[model samples]
Target chain A: MISIRWFLTLTLIALLVLVSFLSSLRGYRESMAEAETLFDLQLLEHVKLLGLLNPASFLFGNTLVIADSVITTPAELELSLQLLVVYQIFDREEKLVIRSENSPTENMAAFEPGYQHAEFNGYSWRALVAQDPLDGHWIMAAQRNDVRYRLAEAVTLQAVLPGVIGVPIAGLLIWWIVGLGLRPIQTLAASVRAREAGDLNVVELDDIPKELTPLTQSTNDLLTRLAMAFDREKRFAADAAHELRTPISVLKVQLHNLLHDLQSRQLPDAAVQTTRQSLQELGQGIDSLAHLIEQILVLNRTTPDQYMRQFTRINLLALVQDVVSNEFEQILARDQIFSLDGLPAFVSGDDTALRSLIQNLLVNASKYTPLGGQITITILQEHNKVLLKLEDSGPGIPEQQYAQVFDRFYRLPDAHHDASVTGSGLGLAIVKHIASMHQADIQLSRSQNLGGLCVTVIFQAYQQDNPA
Target chain B: MIDAVVIVLREVLEAMLVCCVLLASSYALGAKRIWLLPVTLFAVGGALLYATNLTALTDLFDGRGQELTNVLLLMLTGASLLFYLAQLPGVITQKTSGVTPALYASLIVASAAAMVRELAEIFIYIFSYGIASGQTAPVVSGAVIGAGVGVSLGIFIFFGLLWLGKRRCLQVSAVLLSLIGAGMMSQATRFLVQSGFLPGEHIVWDSSWLISESSLTGELLHALLGYDATPGIEQLAVYFASLLIAILLLRKLSVNQSLDVDSLRH
Candidate 1:
């Protein structure tokens, strides 16, 4: 829910901006203070220079020169010194002896010995005064407030400019760097996302971060346990089916012996007849159990995860015909009609699984169809696919229950149908597993002509040069 | 530069905070990240449009057009957020799968309206000084700083919400969005009063002595909750009234929806 990309990008940018700006603000203030001091020192130097000039007006005894109009610079001159700075010289009597054109006639300050503020000529000035040690005359040097402020601010701004400009650039760089740092996470996620459902292998990530080691280790541990569990489940089913087979075979043999013994001894009593009927029912139950065990073995062996695949090209029509011929006796016993149709369709799959797939389907059709019912098998190759369809004229399953019937041990309720017709409930589940192993699709619906269940299995047709 | 930072930061913070809460709320409701890109693009486009047309907008309504329009936009955004909040509990309780189209639409409208309102102000502030005075570098730089801080804080809060998990995330987002929606309504009321569309001279209380609205702490609080040192009766009324309506709507929806067996079980 929380993206590291956004978090790191934003927070790092914020930190960079904050630290950069704060430092710049400090630099701006310090630079401004330094400039202010330098300006004051410059003002003092100007006054001292004028004192060292020791103009002739100091010796001209009460004579004053106040030249208000003068032109001394070229038109292209950038600096107008008069507008920026003004100065005045006074005699020992505090009388104005000589002054710049821009200076007022009166004293600019309080005739002081140090720097002071003065308002004259409708402009605020920072004036500094110094005494001439030779004649004790005074020289006052002043700079206008507006000009000094502009100069000071311009100087200070240059120092803070970098910080302001670097933020956006730093933001971009941080975004990229953070993304680079988080690449391992993205790689690990992609690796996990790309895995197949049955792939329970340990996750392998390149250059994984230490922070993610625990997570990866825990995930691998979980996968190891899951693989073991799946193996246990597969082995358990096969072992249980194998264990049940011997007992079931023994029951069949014992039942047959008892039936033979009962027939050999002629019995006309009603009680004896009931015993014979009971023996027949017991034999049917044993047969159902035996069929259930066989189905469980098939299901365990054909499961996609546990089954080892050895694919070879085989004609689907021949396989279906062979299975139908083998199962024809069951249909004949029930007085049901059977037919096999369609061309030879080549498919790539394990021969054992395909044979099991066809045999189970044929057996299921014959077992469910009523006496005198019809059963049809067809194999067709269309486009790049082979389709095997088995239709039976019997009580068809409801459309809604089609998906549920494929689940192991899930059977249709017997209340509405013939209760005598039994099922192991694992036939379709085994069929589904085998079909999936071969990358096939199964569809169940009502047969149009047979008016019963139509089961269709579609498989990719094997090409010689390009095996499916 | 400091002024620029403060201005841009406050606006960006307000908009980003709204986005964070809404994004968290949408995620809680099982909405996908598909809308985020398009919504952001649209919001930025809207901000540009509003900024470019600012002069024409200012000239309307006898020179009071901007304020009135801001009031309308803020009100609409607040109303949209309220609608989203009302649907939050129901969606979380499994009454629907993910966000419904109507809910998603509300989110889009709310996001765009709030983003445009906040970001246009920053664009206007930046462009006016940057272009006119040739101070583009410093002003834009300050904006970048402000935006960085605001977005960073938004991301932090978004992760904090996620760390709280789904149920608590929804609850916190609801509360945050309620306050934000109320703040928007209060701001809208202020705009209305400033434009003379609503008249109010009554100062319910002044807290400037304690927390001056111009201070940094005050500005952050203002961006978060529309903190006013001198709020009028109308402003107070609208703020509390909108907040109360949002809470009441959430309560009603949650209580009514909780009775459904499927909703409660989920």
Candidate 2:
């Protein structure tokens, strides 16, 4: 896939360079054209001057100038094409008359009416031939071949110098400007990433480009729909539970009356025993149903999609520490030695959700562990992640059933066969789902130290600038 | 060095902009993505033509082959753009236009031709001046910097145009596109005169006395809108004709678009 930003930036820069080169090229060509025209004009001016000089002393001057040409060696000044200009004059009979200091002793060119490139002495020359229309005197102005090229190059370089210097600076400015223009998108993405799953508040961005306004609005709309769906789901579960419990309550009352009536009218011992056992099983089944209903509601409420709780910055250690304190009686009732250990780790999460998650894990540990067992909760900041490890002393779960245990209706084989322990089988499922919604990682393993189930949850830890 | 970079950057930006304009227009019409297919095909096509005709093209019309080819491409792009504008929602044959094969096909042809033309120039140029070296390093670095700047600016412009409310955005695009088409046509005519394929009435108006074409502003305007310092009679005629036709087509499209919208509402 092509990254639009990268593609656009690179392509534009290339195009800019090519265009600039073309501009320089044009400059170079134009400069050469101007040089040619200017040199031709100079030749024309020299022809007029040559017409002014009389041909009477032409032999003596030509001899003197040709003698001086060897001494002058004008070609040595390659930098200044100006110093290389050489001119010669001829009478109508093609006899050499006068010449410039550097002019060749030999005739420059055939008496052409216009420009001609020819060789004289040991070098090439660009010579323009102009004849006097009336007096028929001919004047030829010539400059060395290298001189014209050098002049053109110098002019071209002068014309292209600024381009060579300015493009980089312009490019840098453009890069910075592009970044500024594209910042809104980056900012929006960062803002969305920084929040927890529970954060369903409308995103707020100010002074973003007008184009991104609709995108933000749409994102907010999606959040709204999700929140409404969660509300409806939560409402349905609570309403159904409320309506169900009442009928179950009345049914329990009717069962009680039937038992009393049967007891008052004495029957055969075996028959009475069978009726009582049946009544007991029916009551147990209704209790389990009530428990299941409660667990299902909690599971639904804590799922990320249904999560509607508000987050508060809190010391995770302190919060979990309080939970242990509240559940101390239940732990002690099982004759378990419960311990809490860790520093005051900081994190942000929904208060009620975290409390329920902690309580459910604690309850499960206490219920499952044998009498005189040990339960330990550890919390601390590990790197940037806040880790919480809860270990219990009991027969550790089989390694393979670890994942299956988090399923809503899943119970361990041992728990299922042992009728002495009762469970709605939804505790860990709720814990896993809620932890996920909070963006925490959860791992279930056999505790190395306690020789029992270990539940570990890792939260992304962050500190408040000012502790309140 | 700076000159090489700026020249390349300008050409690449032209191609990039052509792609952006077509894609943006396509998205606005709620169409399937077909522009890339044509663009890629034509890029390869253009490359093949350049590669095969390297000698022949250089030798054509007495060594004016590249110029003639560029001129032809520019005219093709202009025609494609005109066709697109003519089919805007309510214009004649509006029923089969907009998101249909006609519209997307034209967009593809227009954008692809522009890209192929520009890319071929870039390929030729980069090769003409080899990699960065003792004499070329500065130019190469300048090219890199220019690339960054050009792409950044292109993105800014692309997003900025997209941000403009839909109707107005398309309108602004239409206007600029007309200017661009006309500019290309004018440049082609100028080349034609240069190649002696057309009569030269040099200096229809001499703006060079006021501002030389070699100056930065002059070069920039020339790149963006083909502003010539001393435009010839042929260039003026072609530029005006292209511009007028585009304007007329755009007006017709705009009027028809409103009618289409009203009919839909009813």
Index of the highest-DockQ prediction = 1
TM-scores of chain A, one for each prediction:
0.90, 0.75
Summed backbone clashes in each candidate are: 0, 32
Pick out the ten consecutive residues of candidate 1 chain A with the lowest summed lDDT.
A60-69
lDDT of 1 at B35: 74
Tens-digit lDDT string for candidate 1 (A137-170): 8889899876776567666777777766677888
Share of native interface contacts present in candidate 1: 0.48
Weakest 10 consecutive residues of candidate 2 chain B by summed lDDT: B89-98
RMSD, candidate 2, Å: 14.0
lDDT computed for candidate 1: 0.82
Question: How far does residue A41 in candidate 2 sit from its true spot (Å)?
Answer: 1.2
Docking class of 1: acceptable
Query: What local lDDT does model 2 show for residue A464?
Result: 68
